[model samples]
Target: MAATLDGLITFFASHHAIRADKVLRDAGFATELASGPKELSPNCGTALRFELSRTDDALAVLADRHVQVDEVHPYVPRTDAWDRSGSPVRRAKRLWGRRS
Candidate 1:
């Protein structure tokens, strides 16, 4: 919560996600590990949340650290709304959001 985390960085694998989190943290960037947004990607279960303005620098750091990234998405999760409504509504939304 130190930065305006408007970006979501996804990975093809969980290891990559974990590594990216560590690497970014070590580089002094604010980050959070969360479930990859279903609307953005389905390859990995984990994703890194950070500020969008520092995306280029973050990507550079990841590259230097040898972390492979699946994609970078501009995402501002509705966590406050979820918190206010609680998990029941969030869970219901997730369940009803299914295709079949």
Candidate 2:
């Protein structure tokens, strides 16, 4: 079964982000590679989107593999059409926990 996209994982480097994508996918977690939102993460330009509900399992998998993550966030992208008259709105809530 495919996992829902509701969480974002930030990395200190693109290398780690890419590796995370592979690790998560291999561990039966769904993931998507997206440009890291500068407002949320300035450490890297790449971020991995994954299932929020399975965050614990996902993090464990990465930790077991010795992969490091800068931060994890609960992200809900704006779905409405952008208004040229104003700045685009983004929804990202930081999740504080053990970082690995």
Candidate 3:
């Protein structure tokens, strides 16, 4: 896991995440695709992680491509799968809907 996610880009649909991933990667920004945290947005199943250092540049690129983001967050996942006591990070409660 990354020590820190410079920035998070949430989208209303996975399509936006996919497009953003390509654009950000092509622009030389470190990016990753991950399951969207429900605490964040309720729309898409995937989200984008970008270098926080280039947040402004990332936003600008998204705007240039006419991509819409639901929200942006600063996130960093636990580096190790197991904790000191061999426990995993607590999973957030999931919300059920007609879709899944």
Candidate 4:
């Protein structure tokens, strides 16, 4: 199967990470600049999270923007309610019908 873009992309520097975030956003992609998971890399403290299916497009935009990337990890974190399935927010959502 082809690779899914449902993963996190690390940067060589925080500035590049920030720029990539902006570039993707400007390109009409919903992305978030999240703390770099130490296990993923120690090169920068920022990582950009976006829809995995759009990884190729996101990477293309980053390259066009000259954003230095350390790595593109095929990581798919728990998306449903996260680790705390019983947290207040999760609980409320579950109570209201949203399981995630």
**Of the candidates shown, which would achieve the greatest TM-score relative to the real structure?**
2
Residues 1-100, candidate 3, lDDT per residue (tens digit)? 5535667889999999999999888987789998887667889889998777778899999999888888888865645553453234432222223345
**Please, what's the RMSD in Å of model 3?**
9.7
Kindly report which residue stretches of model 3 are placed more than 4 angstroms away from their true locations once superposed.
1-4, 78-100
User: Residue pairs in steric clash, candidate 2?
Assistant: none
Assess every candidate by TM-score. Answer: 0.74, 0.76, 0.70, 0.67
lDDT (tens digit, per residue) of candidate 2 on 16-95: 99999998889878899998877678889999999888889999999999999999998657444323322243211112
Best by lDDT: 1
Checking candidate 1 for backbone clashes, the offending pairs are: none
Q: In candidate 4, what are the lDDT values of residues 1-100, reduced to their tens digit? A: 4333467899888998888888888998887778886667788888887777787888898888888889887655544554353245666666779554
Q: Candidate 2 — what's its lDDT?
A: 0.83
List, residue by residue over 42-99, the lDDT tens digit for candidate 1: 7888999988899999999999989999999887665644534344477667768995
**Candidates sorted by lDDT, descending order?**
1, 2, 3, 4
Q: Which of the predicted structures, 2 or 4, would earn the higher TM-score when compared with the native?
A: 2
Error of 2 at 60 (Å): 0.4
What TM-score, to 2 decimals, does candidate 2 have?
0.76
Off by over 4 Å in 2: 78-100
